[model samples]
Each structure stands twice: as structure tokens, then as C-alpha cells.
Target: MNNRWLLPEYIEDVLPEAAWQVEDVRAKLLSLFKSYGYELVIPPHVEYIESLTGIEGDDLNLKTFKLVDQITGRQLGLRADMTPQVARIDAHLLNRMDVTRLCYAGHVVHTLPAGHFSTREPLQVGAEIYGSKNLTADIEIIELMSSALKVAGISEMNVDIGHVGIFRTICELAKASPQIVDQLFTALQTKDLPSIAELTINWEESLKVAVLALPSLFGEAESVLATARLKLPTVPAIQDALETIERVCVHLATIGVRCSVELGELRTGFYHNGLVFTAFAKGWSNPVARGGRYDNIGQQFGRARAATGFSIDLRDILRGLSTPSGKMSILAPDSQEPELRELIAKLRESGEIVRVDISGGSSDELAWDRKIVKSVNGWEVVSK
Candidate 1:
């Protein structure tokens, strides 16, 4: 008897059914993006560490898998997020002075969280709209996100939307010292309210109560308005930010994009400015997709471009829902190899996703077919 455990914490071994579902979601997203005039851009998973920096903030620096590139003797890191890579493409490679819409489906790696549902590696599908700061761009991204989820057959998924500026506005209004702001940020990250309250204990009663209520201010649009009604009276900056969020929400509702408004939802990178959101599905604790506007990052690379994008964690979504079975048959050529090649090519062009059989005889072909059929369970195979 041999017992071997061969797997790491964050890495995953997805079986056939779930893997097919993941692929299905990726295909649907890609198709939708293409229809919207967004061209595909596939960035390398490995990049110079400096390239990924200044976009994700400290989170990227901490979770990135780093290695010394023997070829160039420079440090390279596995991309933890696709946004920065996309930014680099827009600013340095394409040199498209105008706004460019790019879409991608790829894998990203990060350090695994302890005892959490987070995967160290995940397949992501997303799109970026560059060189546009208009609110229409924001609405369009959210609309596409919802449509993509609908195409994936994922219903009841809620979008929790907020702006980074709103959170920062509150921090400043509280007159929070750098240390206190850092502590409040930590509490915000963990959704810890008690720590926030303790920090504002010495403040005036009204200010202290508003500061403590930050974590609980997350819910529907009306809930955000209700919370803002209280805190905004004392802090003019926060009040103005809240009004902006309310306007964005009203616009979203008018467009029939239904999302629960969350005032304090603020887990984002340094690049975000106008709006940020996370899409949640049933049976998944963490958000399956996250996106927002990041205007400053492109400027850091000297482009001064305004851009926004979101990424879907394919692994998390596959874990939450099942997709239809994909049955593929490898048709072997009986005597005419070219004819069979033509048939395979036609099937591929039609998007049927077929493969050509390469076994020597019928028996060998049948044996190979049986293995796949049995493993996939629902897959059917026929050989001529």
C-alpha cells in the first residue's frame, strides 16, 4: 500500500465537471467582451517585480511569489492581480494614446491565507476600459459584469458598491492621526467595529458614535442613505462624498442594475478612485469578482490615463455552481486523413470544441475513448 499526499495549500486539482464549468464561464465572458469592441490582451504570468508595484500597494508586495530570473538576473514575480499588468500594457507596450478596451482571461497567484477559503492560485476573467473618466464608463462596466454573471447562469448574485474616496473622506473627517488611521484601516479590513470605537473614545460623543458605526453601514441603497443622514451632518466632506455615491446609486437603479449599496465596503488597492464594487454569489463567502476605477496608476507609468476594470475569480465561481457537461469525441480517420482534418477544423470553427483521434486501430481507439467516457461519466464517443 502506498499513501502519498501531493498538493499545496492554495493550489487546486479541479476535476473534469468543475473544470468544464470554469471554462464555460471564461468562454461566455470572452464572447461578451468581444462583442463590446474590447480586444483580448494576454499578459505573461511572470513580470519584473517593479512592474507590478505601485498598483496593488503593499498587498501585491506581500503576497507575490518572487524568484530571481536566471536569464536576466532581475527579480521576477508571479502576478497577483491582472489590473497592474493591463496598465503596463496600455502605458508601455501598445502606446495607444487613445483609450483602449482590453479583455483577458488568465491565472494569478498569491500567498494563501491561513484557514481561509482563499486560493493562492485562481483563474480570472476581466476587462479594462482605458482613457475614460466619464460616469458612463462606470455604468457600462457594472452592466457588463451583471450580464456576464447572468450568462454564466449565476443568479441572485449581489453587487456591493462603494467608493475609495468616500472611505478616505471619512478618515480625514475624523481628524484621525496617521497611527489612528492605520488602526482604523486594520479594523475596516477585518470588519472589526469595537476597535474603531475604542480609537474614537476621546472624541466628542457625536463624532465617536459616527466613527464607531462605520462597519455597520453596509446594506441596500436606502441603508447607506440612512447612515449618511447621521454622520454627514457632522462632517461636510463625508456628506459630499455620500451625495456622490447616492447619485451613482440612483443612476444605477434607473438603468435597472440592481445592487445592494454598501457605504463602508472598502477593500481595494491604491488605484481605485471613483467607484468600487465586489460581486457575491451564494455558497461563496468571498466575492467571486471585484472591480473599480483606477485613474492614477496609468499616470504613474507616465500615461496619465483614466481606467477602470474588474476580474472574476473563476475558481471561486466554479466551486459555487455547476456547469453543463461537455462531451467531446475524438473522431479517427479511417482512410482519408485530410478529410478528417477538415471535419475537425469545421467543428472547431463552429465552436464545438472537438479533438482528433490518433490511436492505431479501432480497438486502441475504443480503449482510449472508454477511459475518457468513464472518467467524464456523461461524455459520449463514436469512432468511424
Candidate 2:
């Protein structure tokens, strides 16, 4: 009897078109990152647990896969998020006098996801901006993020912007107890207004209602603002955050792009101390991408720098892409070896994936296709 548990709940197997879509989206995203002056960086998958400590907050404590290095006897963990690793690079390796823009494309490991179908090992494509505290820098990150999503084949995506400080500021005014603060954060995440109202009775009637109402105050940009204006107190910090969100939408609109603004959104990681935003695809329940301003993470790594950036889960991208097929061509071997190499190099250089036929001349095309050596209907044969 063989006892083998082959499949895990949080990991996935992407096949064919979906797989192709993942790679294609990655390439396009990397290209966009480069065009924006973001230098690509690939961090090692395994690192000393100390390296990733205090990075992703509670998520890190739960999702990391741990192992012991036999030679060094140090505890190692698979990275749960790339942003912290990027932060380490900015603070240590790339400690330059000038601002550094770093981008990463890689897999992040996590345990237990909100959705049953979520991947345990998620592929991410994202960028991090260092050495800038200017609001314009935040806006540029948002702008570039929107453009990158469009390039990834998300035609009608919506970006919802929020400020972490707004909710925290409001909580302070409410004088929320620890229980109430946790409950408020939970209610905001779940969008449960009644529960929030239940916990808010100790505050002023109008304030309680306003606090409770925030959970439901989300919609189209204008509608969200209209609803929020009626529900929220006239606090300067909250108002400023709202104004920042408004400006972001206005900036996107002038570029002929539309984004929804929401003030109640919360980030899984508290890294974002300022503005936070999420990108959603039509018909998808959860966000395909999320990022925000973390002015403090750099400080934690020995540099008191302000930073903001965003990342997309490539697995979600594969789920959202409406592309019909993920195909690549491989030219069959030529009688002249140099010709075959030339064709392969030329195709790859032009950004088209191709494989040179290395097997003997009479290799079966059907068998090769079955092995995924070339995408179905994406192979060609040439003879010299």
C-alpha cells in the first residue's frame, strides 16, 4: 500500500493557457518596471529567519516554511513577502546616495488564505521606491501601477485607494478600547456595519453612527465621497487623507483612467503607514494587486526612509487573464546547425520564447507537444 498525500490545499497547479498567461504577465510587468527606472532584483528564496523577522507582521509568523541548515545550523525560512527583502537590499546592499527604485518578480509563501482556492506559494511582481517622502512620489507609484496593470491585459480594472492613517485617526477620536479597536478593524475588513454599530454605543450618537457607517461607505468615486461627507466627522487628518485620494483619482482621470476611492480599506500588513490602494479586476471578488506607503519599514532596517510600492499576485493574474491561449513557438532543427541556433536566438531576442530542437532530427512533434516542449499549435519546422 502506498500512502502519499500529493496535493496541498493552498498550493495550485496551473496548466497551459493559465501558465502561459502568468509568464506573459510577468514579462510585461517587468518591462513596465524597467521603463520606470526600477532596477530588477531577485532575492534568494531561503534566508535566515532574522533577515525576515518583524517584516510582514502576523502573516510572517503563520505562513513561513522553516528548515534548519545542516552545515551552519541556523534556522532558515522561505520568504513570505518580497517587500521586506527589498527593504533589506535598500538599507544594506544598495545604500547609495541617490534614490533607488527596485523591482522584484518572485514567489511568496504563505499559509492559510482567505479564499479556499488561494495559492500557498504566490508569484508576485512589484516595485519599491526608496528615498522619497513627497506626495508626488506616491502619486507616481500609483500612476505607474495603473499603467502596468493595463499592460498586463487587465482592460477594465479598478484601483481603490485608502489611507491607513484615516482609520487609525478616527479610532483615536472614538477613544476605542482594545476590544473595540480590534472589532472595528474586523468590521471594516468584513464590511459589517451592524457589528460596528453594536460596539460604538459608548461614543456620541452622531459619532457612533459615523463610525459604524464607515464600513458601508464605499462605491464609485463621487458616490463614496458623497456618502463619506454625510457620515464622517470634520477631522482635519481624515479630511486630508480623503483629499489625497481625491487627487489621485483626479490625476488618473486627466490621463483618461478611472479609479474608485474608498477610505475604509485596511492593509494586511501595517507596513503602509500612509496611503494604501488595491487593484481589482472585473468579476473578481478579491484584489489582484495591493500596495501602499510604508515610511517606516526602511527605518526598521537602519535607515529612516519613507517608501511606498505595490505588488500583484501572479497566481491571481493567471486566474483573471481572459487570454485564450498561452503559446510559444519552437523551430525544428535545420540541416545546418548554425541556422537553427540563429533562428532560436533571433526569436528569443525579439521577446518571443523559442526552443531549439536538440533531440535527433526525427523527433515526433506530437510527443514533443505532449511534453509541453512547445505550446500546442505553436511549433514550426524548417529544413535547409
Candidate 3:
């Protein structure tokens, strides 16, 4: 056998049954988004490196699969995420000054598996709304994600929300050195108190206290907000971030999507400058869906539109779930008669799948629910 027959690690084909389930979920999500006025757009699988992963997306740059374009002799990158592509569309393609809601579903190739249970290739499905920075816009996106989860049959979910502005504000106030900032950020993300204490040890008393206290600021929305208000530096940017979270949480509660506030979280989308969110379904350790506000992401495309959206790994969504059933077929005897062909056509048009039995039929190999039999009244449906 050829050595190439064995595929590389973390990459594999999506077989029929699982592919069907992923497609089913994708269709349901897109349909739901359409009903809410989000239009669909398809971006190329690859593009020039710079346009695909924006400037501040250094983290994403590491995740992207880059290659030299043979035709243009320029470097191109397969998208690891679709957010930048959608932002480009909003900024350049549509060029809409008004608020735009766009949805897309496609395969994205990552240099490595995203996390546990993730493949190098995943079908990413998501929606993005641009040209708005209001907290209501964030709430709407979260609601949309919740609606998709409910449709996917996820009954229980937890939304852990956060804001990067909190850290940004603290950094600005402390005028922290690069080392201290990096250490503090890493500690906060991982909730490593010792690392935080060690990093900020040489810092001034007030700044050190604030940085060290950051990790303990995660919990229920109201309580976290109350504590954060007192513990965090009282800067305008930080206050605005807190207020935005408060309003979004309150609005979500009214819609029954209540979430706990996570002050220390900086989602993998490092460019996220404002509110961020990740959703956990019952029985799953990782988030089923994630997104946040990366307001200036579009400026890389030469337009600054406030953007927020959420994306789900279609493969992840189907994991630990039963494969979706494909269309059931009706067994019919092969015939050239006009009446039989007409009947088959009618059945197919009416949304029934009918498979004609040929000379070498494999009844033992395949199971069909019903068979067509001829009666005085014409073809009749009979139990198999």
C-alpha cells in the first residue's frame, strides 16, 4: 500500500453519517440566522497572509497554515478562523455604512488541533454583526448563539463572560513594563496567583495589589461586578467595560441567557478589545461556542466597524451525539413502464426517497422500511 494512504495526524475525512449530522446542524443554524436577517457569505479557503490574519492577530498568525502562492509568488495563508474574512467582507465587499449582519459556514484549517476533541480541519459556523458598539448588539449576538444551541438540542448551557478592557485599563494606570504585563496577563488567564505575585513583586504597592487581586474577581454577574467595582482600578475605560458587562448581563437575564462574569478571561481572540464570551454546554469541558467584540478588527481592511459574533465547531457540536438519520428509501421493482416511472417521479417530488431494485439487488446488505407492490388499484405501500 502507498505510504500516502495513511493521512497526517489530526486530519481525516468526515464520513457519511457524521457529515450528515454536521450538515444538519449547519442548515438549522443558517436557517435560524436567515430568519433573523443575517445574510450568508462564503469566503475563499485561502488568501494573502496579511489580509487573512490582521496585524494584531499575531496569535492567529501562529495558528495559520501559510504557503508561498505559486502564481503570484507571494505568501498565502489558509484561514484558521473566518472572523477576519467576514470583517473584510463587511468593510470592503458590501461597504455598508449601515449595520450589517452576515453569517457563514465553511471548513477552516488550523495548523494544529484547536483543543481536546478538535480536528485540524473543522466546519466553522458563525454570524457577525458590524457597525455597532452598543451593549444591545452584544446581547443580540449572545441571544442568537443561545438560539442555535437550543435548536441543536443543547438544553443546559453556561455563559462565562469577560472584558479585556479591565486588563487594558489596569495596564494603562500602572504603566506596566512589558515583562510585568505579559506575566500578569498569563497569570490572569491561567488563574495562577503565585505567578502573578512573583511578576508584580517589584511593582508599586497600589499597582501590585490591583494586579494580584484580578484573579479572584470571577463569579456570579452581580457579585463579580460589585467586587470588581471596588477592587479594580477606578479608570474610565475599566468602568465603561464593567458597565457594558452589567447591561449585557441584565439584558441576557431578561431573555433567560443569564451568565456568570469572568473578569480574568482573555479569550484566544487576543484582538478582542471589549466584551468577550464563551459558552459551555452541560457535560462538556470546553466551550461549545465562543465570540467577543473586536471593534477595530476591520480597520486592517481599512474600515473600522464595531464587530461581535460567535462561532461553533460543527464537529464539536455533533460529538457525543447520535448520528443524524439520512433519508429513508422505498424499495421498488425495476420497471420501464411509464406508469411506474411516473409514480417514482411523483414519490420523489413529494419528498420520498425511492431506490429501484435492479437484477442484482442486495436486500440482505441494505435495510429499507417499505416496499412497493402492485395491486388492482395500482402500486401500494407494504411493510418490508
lDDT of 1 by residue, 26-144 (tens): 88889999998899999999999988766644667877889999999999999888888888889878878677899999989887652257678888789889988887787778878
- The lowest-lDDT stretch of 10 consecutive residues in candidate 3 is 359-368
Residue 270, model 2, lDDT = 52
lDDT of 2 by residue, 1-384 (tens): 755746777776777767767787789889888999999999999898877767534556566778899889999888888888999899888887677899999988876674546678889789889888788888888888888878777777777887877777777887877667767776787788777878776887877766666656677887898778777877898788778888888887888666877777885465667888888877667787789988868666787677889887777766765656435454455445565456566767987655445666555442223122223544344332
lDDT of 3 by residue, 100-144 (tens): 999999999998887887789988999989999877788889999
Candidate 2 residue spans exceeding 4 A from truth: 1-5, 14-21, 53-57, 69-75, 96-98, 114-116, 177-180, 204-206, 322-384
How well does candidate 2 score on lDDT at residue 264? 75
The most accurate candidate by lDDT is: 3
Q: Candidate 1 at 49: error in angstroms?
A: 1.5
Error of 2 at 250 (Å): 0.8
Q: If the candidates were sorted by their TM-score against the true structure, best first, what order would they fall in?
A: 3, 2, 1
Evaluated at residue 117, the lDDT of candidate 2 is 60
For model 3, the superposed segments whose C-alpha errors exceed 4 Å read: 1-3, 177-183
Candidate 2: residue 150 Cα off by (Å): 1.8
Give candidate 1's root-mean-square deviation (CA, Å): 5.6
Q: For each candidate, how many residue pairs have backbone atoms clashing (under 3 Å)? A: 0, 1, 0
Model 1 clash pairs are none
In model 3, state the lDDT of residue 221: 90
Question: Which candidate comes out best when scored by TM-score?
Answer: 3
Give, for candidate 1, the lowest lDDT window spanning 10 residues: 366-375
lDDT of 2: 0.75
